[model samples]
Target chain A: MSTGPYNYSYIFKYIIIGDMGVGKSCLLHQFTEKKFMADCPHTIGVEFGTRIIEVSGQKIKLQIWDTAGQERFRAVTRSYYRGAAGALMVYDITRRSTYNHLSSWLTDTRNLTNPSTVIFLIGNKCDLEGQRDVTYEEASKFAEENGLLFVEASAKTGDNVEEAFLETAKKIYQSIQDGRLDLNAAESGVQHKPSQPGRNNLSNDQQANKDNCAC
Target chain B: MACLWSNSNEVLIQIPLTEEIDNVTFYQISVKVGEIKWNVKHRYSEFYNLHNQLITDHGVSKDILPSKKVIGNKSEPFIENRRKALEKYVQKIFIFLRQTMPKIFVDFLDFHLYDIYFLLQDLSLLCFTKGDLILSSSRVYSFKPIELYAINEFLKSPAPNFTNSSKQLDLGPILDLCSQLDAFIIHGCYNDYLKSNIILNKLPIDLSPFKIQKGLYLSNVSLDMVTSLGNARETVTTLEVVFSNVKRISDILQCDILHKNTLEESQKWKVLETLDLSNNNLMDIDESINLAKNLKHLILDNNYISTVSDLTQLPNLENLSIENNLITVCNDLHRKIGNIKTLNLSLNNIVTGKGFYKLYSLETLNLSSNKITNIEELECLGRLPCLEYLVLNGNNVSSSIDYRVKVLEFFGERAADIYLDNEKPSEAELDKVSILSALRIVKEGKTPDLSMNGSS
Candidate 1:
């Protein structure tokens, strides 16, 4: 039944992680709901939001998990880090303290998620040029030193938000096309779906659904 | 590098056991590099070939590999001894020629298992074919994680000046120079950047142009009875219409496109599967949501609803999340959304577990951040046969002493089955549960089970 003309071909599990009030849920709202939540509640626990996206001509369903960013919720949020194909680590550009916690967040991400999980570093609230605390060049340098994709996006303005999520998918999709990430691996964080009818070969990242039901 | 699970790029070659096939012993090399783990088996002859090549081709003269015992080499003791020595040999090559890791040795460990090897080979050939005019930043390498690990290797490498390793694929010098570098960067570094570039100088990619946009995401607009589910595409299967007005699910069905001849007789819900209506102000669990009988997953989180009422019409509701609702009681929840496998009621005002009386198919229940204060509230959960994962974080009883043990005690022999607060009962907790079960038996004056040491 997934062979519908426009059904997505892959589901990539993504986890959005960062410090408290760094706009983790806001970024998810801006990406999926396409609007800013000025009164977004501080997340009580993990929240689920998904948006289907396209990368390299392939339809990919992004099952994004937005977790509570408070330190007290670390135990609950830590469980969400596993099996993530992409991790968006957000930090407030206006708060130097939030930027200082990057190393701690990076350690958790590198430890919990698999090795191939793409980590995208985002400097949220870039629209607040007046209260800017973290410089773009320093964060860019940090991203270059560490192996992470970097972007300065404002969830309120919706600037570079789509690109951060999509570029991570593009790299993940390319990994699939090139065979770096094996779908058979449990920790690969990707599920293959039967492509729509007449979409071409079953090779490359395209494989029949595990149930193998052609309908 | 401070990660607890995967050691950073430390190659661990564990030869725990060996296999014998057709009188030839194969030593299994269980290899683990950081988070990547794989297995490669090799016979003694293959080891000898790798050892010979390491010395002859790569100039590795330190041949400390166990001496070849052609006679009785297949014996038990000999295979055992060779297993240990072969492990040492592989580890030595990994540590010795780590900087200029020869291709023969890299192949021995299967480090080049991915398409990255082939792509790097293509880049190496290109750099060799062309002169060193272009910068390494001009071309991009596929692997990003390896690029970071390669930094430490590139810096520690005694001779970082590896120029145009045209020996085909550059798997050795590339991976050895901390693999997956901008070939131009490495070569260009050899000529220019190496002397002048700072330590943190890695290629930066501008990802703005890669704005990912494939499917339709509802733009900034409030949903109405007309524009909410009404305007959904004919082929759309998933609908995420949130931050909307108009109470009752029946209103969403008022869209002309959704209702075929009439609202109740609509087959348009056939193609629709998952619907997310979070952040809505609703007072009722209108039965029309079940009009789409095939709807399996429904998320109604962050609503102003008070009860788990009116969801019985959904025949295939497998997964449901009503996380942030105003439901203070759950006495008849199973009667409403009963056979669903996964349920999330975290951050609610549920006081008792009796509502979960007969959810036989419930496997994962997340009731974290709720207001259940009493330890007896969990006793009601012992009836559900399939309740395996029960999360209770932020609840009052979770902070009580022996909270995990008291909860595990209720499961009795199935204590190991239940996962309290998203974590399974540890070995000590399971032992305590067993002891508690035995104590209860003794107090009741019943005969002790044969598994215990108590005399009947």
Candidate 2:
């Protein structure tokens, strides 16, 4: 048997959604690019990023879609909701409107994506503790009430940011291992790779294609 | 000039000029005359005449030969006869005007220019009415100045003739188009046609509302749409069916709207996990839970469900809440949900007894707002190796249960070690007489040696 970093074994599709100014784009940037973009313009339709991460000794590639936050743009961005393996339901800790709109956002996430999609509720901008509009206790209780995995994270400070993405990936990876998420299904948003020779060359070709197209 | 009259059979008369009038003016006057005569001098003195011509001439009528014309040709005998009649009536009026007034007739040529101008104006107004009729009937009028002027006048005038000019824009077609495109971004109030019709039926199965992207909000949807979505099994993952009066999930199970191969090709529904079907009028919970196999968390709060038997077989369920139901007992609940970590049975009528004894792995239990009146039954839960936080607020135990101190004393050491409520018992609170008395009983009696054995 031959092995060279074991070409990606699992591919997880993630979707980030929330109200405007909730820093969904920032959280995505911090997780995929590992750097904070302070002056990043708001998303117009949907932005995509991919990164290969190792979890449980398995190389998993996360395909994340960052969507526009405007209500009218939901028509254009909603198509990205299909085939998601993980969904980050983000809310701004400093804005109660963003917190209060969680149920509406949760309803959307529930109605659109597949059943295996891992929903992680993230209270973003946790560094703005002074202007906190939603108490951690209350948000945590809400997360419990809604049956969502929750955490208070800051993209600017990188606190719990990595944990949120990694936790979603771990949950998806676990689902694949458990056979709950079938890799052969069309909309499962997962692709399973069998251990084989010359798989790296095939992946490099795919990476090159990915570099050519901005999905 | 002379007056001419037509008889019933074939009599006719014509006017004749007395003097050889050179360059004479011809005046045409139309009058509505009857047996009762009204004064006409004041209205038409400038053109009317009574003392001009005194001559009459009659000619024998000639029958013309019929020409060989096409059957549909207008230049035939009948049309020619009607035209001759019209010319005779005009000539008679002109002759009568010349006969009535000699001086007025002499000056008529000078002021005759004014009559021709007014006659052309009347003809133009008549043409405008005809144009209006054509435009309204055919709707093919060119954008000419005259047509545009008439349309503007019709729009501005508050006449009832042009009713319904302010037609409402129909939204049914737009909604139908959006549904055909598989777009589910519904917002704002559409027209009545779109509001009542269920366009979800026409949408493709793959892009139906059940297959909509996650994190979408759909308000004011009908029961038909909800049922259509519920019937969509493998494609729909995370769904929050709210606001509508959905009484039974079985209504959704009957639609068979999902692709048959969706579940077999299980990768199609890989992303769906959480489903919130709360605040409905559901009395049974079996059908909704059976849709998604990978469902992890289920919230059935604020329903009329009296039993939890339907939720027993969900293997991956971690967080389950049947709070505010009418459940009176927790029979076989622990065995059914051996893997569940959080269970909320609050706001029910459960009595503190052996019903809650076997939840061995429960981490947090909320039994608040129940009629539990004693803490003795809580000793059964002490056997649960993982019980960490327990909310007994709003129950009758705080007031009627005198053994609260005794129950806390029995598990106080373990409870404090687990950091229950994030605090250790204070010295004064632990030294209370009620708690000390229970501790003395445990020390004197065999109490099963219930101390930490480092086995959990």
Clashing pairs in 1: A1-A215, B121-B169, B136-B184, B136-B185, B150-B178
Query: How do the residues B64-108 of candidate 1 rate in per-residue lDDT, one tens digit apiece?
Result: 878877677767887888898888887777677765556676567
Q: What TM-score did chain B of candidate 1 earn?
A: 0.49
Query: For residues B1-456, could you state the per-residue lDDT of candidate 2 as single tens digits?
Result: 000111112212221211112432222222212211111111112222221121222121222212323354343454445334433633454454432322233233221111212222233444445545543464222222122222223234343221223322122332222223221333212223221221322222222322343422333334453323432344445555544345765443333444332233322234446665567787867544454546667776787888776453354566677788787776646434534557788887888746656544356777778788777766676555445666666777756544444445545444332323334445454566335655576788856332232111
DockQ of each: 0.01, 0.02
The alpha-carbon interface RMSD of model 2 comes to 22.8
How many backbone clashes does every candidate have?
5, 27
Q: Candidate 2's residue-wise lDDT over A34-70, tens digit each?
A: 7799998977656666667788766776767787788
Candidate 2 chain B weakest ten by summed lDDT: B35-44
Each prediction's fraction of true contacts recovered = 0.00, 0.00
Worst lDDT 10-window in candidate 1 chain B: B184-193
User: What are the Cα lDDT values of the candidates?
Assistant: 0.66, 0.55
Cα lDDT of candidate 2 equals 0.55
| Docking model 2 quality class | incorrect
Report lDDT (Cα) of residue A38, candidate 2.
98
Please name the candidate that would achieve the greatest TM-score relative to the true structure. 2
